[model samples]
Target: MNWPPVPQVDLLEGLHLRYGVLATELRLLSDGLDEAARTFRVGVGNGPDLALRLAAGDPRPVTYFVLLHLRDRGVDAVVAPLPTMTGEAFVRVDGLTWSLYPFFDGADGWTHGMDVQAWHNLGSALRAVHDVPPADAVVPREAFDVTRYDGLTAWNAASR
Candidate 1:
């Protein structure tokens, strides 16, 4: 996969100054223009792993709010955004938006096989997230129309 340009040392230093994230090492986790972000696994000495994301065009404030809400709801599965030294959820460094999160180690179900218990755990997490009360006007909701897939609809009709 095509990865975004790696962050330079100066930018990392800026992150250190702003967020206190001292990156001893960095490993690219994923990149996508659709997501408008590039993620990295930041290694810190004697500290838990951190996920640092550099986003060009994302509604980060809203996203950060939602993550914080989930965390407040006691949903431990979600990776909540870490606050900067100035108590900001995210900061801009070198013209790119940066956010930090606690990294959780887990295999991708798409690449690595998941057992029945794993699936159950995933379902439980999803249920927990759904049980949380919405932020109402704070977060906007998007409607998904499955009927938009004409080919799939026709196939389902024929199969029935």
Candidate 2:
């Protein structure tokens, strides 16, 4: 809660004005000091629930584009962020990046118990994501040099 703090009513109102979503309830779904993002289950009146996330210092715009691409590529497992009235993927509110996604029911593979079909579906999804051409600017590239990793350097020195 301390990381980004709970969103105020005005913020939600702004969300509605910008995205045309009428958020009726905002229930916190993630709670921890170490969490990277504060997630909430948003209840929309007369519509499917949406998941709201507030994260700081994340490259959300690129991520949103990639997710949108993945969904377009027939990856049903991934949920694309809802675009604003201006067609922007994410909005900045009080120094935190806020994005909304269609909340899908069902737990992750770990919790829901992945069967054979589930594994196959997961593999297909991974293939679809990985198959995205690198030419696309939205695809994230390696941000750091692996040779500079302290743990890897230590392991290499110990092995020598």
Best prediction by lDDT: 1
Candidate 1 per-residue lDDT over residues 88-129, each given as its tens digit: 888876557888888888777777889999999899999999
Give the local distance difference test score of model 2. Answer: 0.77
Question: In angstroms, how far off is 64's CA in candidate 2?
Answer: 1.7
Q: How much does candidate 2 score in TM-score?
A: 0.74
Per-residue lDDT of candidate 2, residues 1-160 (tens digit): 4575554696579768878887888888743353667777888888899887778775556768888877777777788988888898888877778888888766776556888998998898788778766436775577787656769878999999
In model 2, residue pairs whose N, Cα or C atoms come closer than 3 Å (at least 3 residues apart or on different chains), thus clashing, are: none
Find the 10 residues in a row with the least total lDDT in model 1.
Answer: 1-10
Off by over 4 Å in 1: 1-7, 31-35, 140-160
* TM-score of each model, in listed order: 0.74, 0.74
Alpha carbon lDDT of residue 52, candidate 2? 79
